[model samples]
Target chain A: MPPLPVITGLGFITSIGQDRATVGRSLRELQHGFERVEFFGNPNLPVKVAGTIKGFDFPTPSWRDWRWPDRFTVDRELLRGLAPHGVYALCALQQALTEAGLEPGELGDGTTGLFCASAGSPFMLGSFLGQMRETRGERGNPMGVVSSIAGTLNFNLATHYRITGAVCGFVSACASSSHALGYAMDEIRLGRQQRMLVVGAEDMTDESIMAFSSLRALSNNPDPATASRPFDRRRDGFVGTGGAVALIVEDAALARRRGAHIIAELIGWGQAGDGHSVTASHPEGAGLREAMRRSLADARVNARDVGYVNAHATSTVAGDRSEALALHATFTSQGARPRVSSTKALTGHGLSLAGVMEAAFCALAIDEGFIPGAAHLEEPDPVCTGLDLPRTSLAEAPGLVLNNSSGFGGSNVCHLLRRPA
Target chain B: MKTSAPSPTASTEHEQSIRHLPAPARAAFEQFQAGGDPATLDPVVLAILADFSPRASEIPLADLPGDTMLIDDLGFDSLAITEVVFAAEDLFRINITNEEIVQVRTLDHLRGFIRAKVAGRSAR
Candidate 1:
């Protein structure tokens, strides 16, 4: 409605690297995080590779003191006793708040809202399912059912952060966080809240692994180095990765007054549904084209102003074709095409976390003046032959960047970002 | 072929009013089944499962064959099994007791259990 809010600070955790510098270096080098995991019971599932996070130590010691109940046991045994999405959201929020130099009480009571996008159910589901299967002959624990619901994560995150403002969770499949960011930006732009915390968190689980494997939508190229090759002709599918990202967005005037380091401005956002199939995207990329056009229109910027585009190309056979066609059509119609690149090749598909993680990358790209090329792309798809996908590195100073996320069920979102003058 | 036994009904009639779930709710249901194992399951289901299994790494779901004993075949201790049960109950919005859990040995059984709970709730 009003002028969109500005992103003051950003934080993300992914398999490629944790901090910005480390992740930035990996992206610049085009490093891949895929590797074979023997823990999955199926030795013949074809896709043995994944972009897994290693050596992450949780800061909360209280989790260790808690009782190892049925659900807790699942967390401990399967997830290595890590905190759920709610807890991760809180932790990421804390970091974003700290980066923005805001105290716990600074945002004032009931003025600070929490908005998040999550693709996975809480980590408790697998443990409960395993328990249900094992305890089939006995009475199951009552707490397991309660702890495993999807909404519980949002509720817990709000309570843990002591956020009194509106609390909403957006679940648009892979576009979950992108939509959440767009919504949060709109809320702040309309003067509903002084500050908003937007988060995208995911917890990869077994059901997710098998589901992708069954569809052959995962890269089976055992070598972690070459597993996720987005835009590459030999690309098989995406590497399922996990992580959380948090961004603190506030009014540009308010942030500058407080001397906060303004990273980028969220000028426009567009959301659309394909009304297409539930799993695959439309071949012509009609939904994606509309979303991008709408975003540019909302930003009041011409297509020529866009410096780079962060694509949602997950390296799938159908998905890549659809996205490429969409980009070509959109840019051709405007007579000005921007350089397009897919980061999923490096980070794998983070699902709900992808939008925010890539948003963080966009912010970094604007600041760093370089758009990382698609990681293992030796040859672009023939369908995308006409598109100007950056195979080699490009170091153009970006004035504006657009991030695209297309999810299952025809959900698509595009966010237009501008470098702060 | 004998049809599988139907699931238990929901406790309240008021909860049965809504039959079709919006995209988010359906997504949550699919996610519940793919818990903690994204590599094997469908991406849609994996997206849902990721919600609950944040720390879930790559584990093959095929190893968890329908006929495989949850404890013996899967090498899951009591705690792991309980987590899976909790996920099912939460996603399906049904109350599955320890006794009901004991009857679920395979993926098919788990799906049936959830369907029965939903059906029962709708019947009310």
Candidate 2:
């Protein structure tokens, strides 16, 4: 059997934080990263809040005008065909590679591969497509296809990094990055590649984010603090957010030989789908429950040994209920209680990025010796009544951590992680 | 993405393969791309080329006269050409067809193309 894949390097660019130290501090202090703003600048839109990303400039959705923190030096050529989210992903990748002591531009020896997930740059698509339509379909930006589609990340990132290994784009919506991570693990475990870079990013634009409001899945509450109260009875809906997160999933044996500091071991992962509904999960959280059980069984660890669970409860009424029911059936009702919380209560739901971002949080918790607690859970829902939803950070190192991530197509993926031995 | 060249290597090789043509074509391209005052290129057209040609900002836009190589002398890829065309269209309020974009190898070609379009529109 192959050694488990370990997370050696992590790079984060999220609403809550952008680095290990800042992210650790934010999670530890329960700092809520939210802001009230009229998406689309249209007063008629219902939702007025989001977990807005800070310290980035987006005067226009165009990548040319978009500027992240000046600390990272990026070539102008690389930005030509990118969207805002692509830039974020690249910036996050820089951080990850640096932490892993991997040199950029030299990672193309075929040992390193890249997998990326993003909802795509809808705002940039709107801009480019708008131009095409206005021009009567004659001509538009040449990079329209590579910069806007769901697979944009694969094309741009793979070509940029020049990875010769398996490069794929996962599009399971919110569960996209989890699928990427899972496949990356298989690639490393199968000895196909020494390491794999998994990146997930999303555009924080009216076209990209407010489009979800059409489904009424976004919080209508104007108050940023209480807008994303996952697992709470008063929770209205998930608050949307965007940015990028990245992880370097390396082979444990390779990492150990190279003396790389492993943050967490991705012991096992499992994925299942809810065949019942197109958008909603199984009413009883059947798919999620199965995913958790499969993950535990795959990891060959007792369910009772799992110390922390990063719940996928996104604060939506039905979504939270579904996840809570799944949690109860999987752990609580089985007499094995685990500390559970939805970090979404602070960071908001980052859609496709949720999987990798939450998983990275688990890695941070293990590395920083703190478990992030649910931020604004004043009142628990009836389904989550027996669940332990700590409303603040737990100042203890977690033994076994499970991160749950689900998507619109009823796709579900769960990962089991633990502190490196 | 569509670029002026089907491929950068192919375009560069194609231009260089023609021993005599590449120098003149490159000269014309360099003059216009370098923002040099080529008598055939209008100052406005030269400015647009200079601005969009990746690193041609240091080239004097409306001063020198002479052409330079066209393909792969610098890193101006196909996407940059599309951007140049888009900017030229918006600035001159003229629509340039793919055929016209393909014919423009040097800054002189671009000047001729845009000058004719702007002149034709004014005459109309």
- Chain B of candidate 1 achieves a TM-score of 0.48
Residue-wise C-alpha lDDT for candidate 2, range A257-371, written one tens digit per residue: 8888999999989989998888888888989999998899988987899889999999999998999999989988779888999999989999999999999999999888888
Instruction: Identify the candidate with maximal TM-score.
Output: 2
- For candidate 1, write residues A1-421 as lDDT tens digits: 3545888877656777755677777767777666677535678667777666654432222233323213111233323333454445545666677778888676548767878777545446666567558545233433455345545445556655578887898888899899889988888888888778888887555554556676677777777777777767788788887767888888887788899988889999998888899898988888999999999999999888988889999988788888888888888666877888888888888888899889888987887778778777877778767667777667777678999999989999999998897
* TM values, all candidates: 0.71, 0.89
| 10 residues in a row with least lDDT, candidate 2 chain A | A58-67
lDDT of 1 by residue, B1-124 (tens): 1112324434342132112233454554445444633222233222333333324435644334456454554455545555455544443445667677777765555555555676675566
**C-alpha displacement of A237 in model 1, angstroms?**
1.4
Q: Which residues of candidate 1, in runs, are more than 4 Å off?
A: A1-3, A57-83, A86-88, A129-147, B1-124
Q: Residue by residue across B1-124, what tens digits does model 2's lDDT show?
A: 2322111224354343222222444455446445533343365555556545656435564444435434445457767887777765554446677777888776556667777776665565
* lDDT of model 1, residue B41: 27
RMSD list, candidates in order: 15.1, 7.3
